[model samples]
Target: MGMRLYAIVIYLFLYLPIGIIVLFSFNAGRHASDFHGFSVKWYGKVLSNPFAMDALTTSVTVAFITALLASVFGTMAALGLQQFKGRFRALFDAAIYIAIMIPGIVIGIATLIALVTAFGYLNPALAAAWPEWLGDAPRLKMGRVSLIAAHTMFTMALVIVIVRARLAGMDRTLIEASADLYATPMGTFWQVTLPQIFPAVLAGFLLSFTFSFDDFIIAFFVAGSETTLPIYVFSSIRRGVTPEINAIGTMVLAVSLSLLIVAQVMLRRRDRPAA
Candidate 1:
């Protein structure tokens, strides 16, 4: 009974703020401190706000591309690591964890500097090589492309971890059987390996999408002129919080929680024993 009470207290402590945000999202009052009444005006306000809409669109686009790229490349990476043996593999595994554990600000700064330096050199080289149309073309500096790359850099580590966990628990006999049947590497992967680990891939994709969508620190550094949803929200806060902001927060929380719940359900189902 004591433990149950403690667990209840912990859950309330964790979710109380979220509950307040959701509850007050519908509050007719503009002031966050008071709830004058219940209304959906705030939702309409959020929908009608051009800045919010544009930011939402940009965030969705980035998250979609990030998820797709992370899923494909991360799965490939997991497969490579699974087959690898030796000290290098151990080093690589440690590196993935380090990337995951690193602060977002550090990653953002490092990514920004690296991209700027690379583009600085590459732009000059390209201009020299092609003095015509290519020379005058705007060189890649920092913007959506850089933001996507930064997101992929960290999120890919998460994907690799998820897919690798799945791979580690997979049956090797099935792969051996495919090899015995004279299946090509590609054929075996498509037929035998992919289906087995697809749940983890899907989970990774969902997680990547969520991370990219809600990310603010890295996106702020690398976004250039583009404004993602999180960055927009942060900018809006300087002007003071309104019901519209609350509504947006509620919506973001809903989407993130929904994705997380779905991912958890998928993973649980994958782990369940078949009768």
Candidate 2:
């Protein structure tokens, strides 16, 4: 059928480049395109490359911290938003969706400008206020901390949306029964509410980690001196794409796919009907 053919074409269009990268990752030749034979020397080289390992370490650290902060804060925001009434709730709902819809480039540029402006003022003021004994007051700048904050701010919206969706489907009677039993609000949350929404939160955390790890646009602007895996890959590609780069891309793809699968499983578990 024409429709089936069209769908096949679309699928190939979307994934053919990725498939090429994976297939060529084992290329024995120095060139990525000319695959003389299959070998994983490139993978070994990537693993042994100190710069690549350092960048991977930074990416993992930033993504882990970002996921934790986003999950906690976003869950709290979702809970608090449940109390909003009418227009107020609509306004916030719009804002959260808008944050998710905004382009990564816009966020990166805005974050870069905001950090630069804040540092400009805060650095001078801190210097003026510092005691003479503490040789040189530390100044704020874009780096790992800034990267984490930007990633957390962007990913928190994802967690809020996921948790809120789960909360909407939750059994209200369970919460009501807990309240009727004279349980404290915190007790009700821990016992009755958290148990239901925890899967969504975990899924959100995994998704957030994946996004932060794979991100390049936002990290490119705000990373300062801190290099992430994506940034390193980008830098490498500027020179030329080699088998080493292909191997790195393949590994990144594998990790991203694994996280996505786990997140999907968590979401599926949450959506499963009560046994």
What digit string (tens of lDDT, one per residue) describes model 1 on residues 174-242? 999999999998999999999888888999999999999999999999998999999999998888877
lDDT of 2 by residue, 1-275 (tens): 99999999999999999999999998898876566998989899999999999999999999999999999999999999988889989898888887899999999999999999999999999999999899999989999999999999989999999999999988898899999999999999998899899989999999999999999999999999999999999999898777888888999999999999999999998668643
TM-score for candidate 2, please give it: 0.94
TM value for model 1: 0.93
User: lDDT of each prediction vs. the true structure?
Assistant: 0.91, 0.93
- Alpha-carbon RMSD, candidate 2: 1.7
Q: Where does candidate 1 clash, by residue pair? A: none
Q: Give Cα distance to truth, residue 171, candidate 2, Å.
A: 0.8
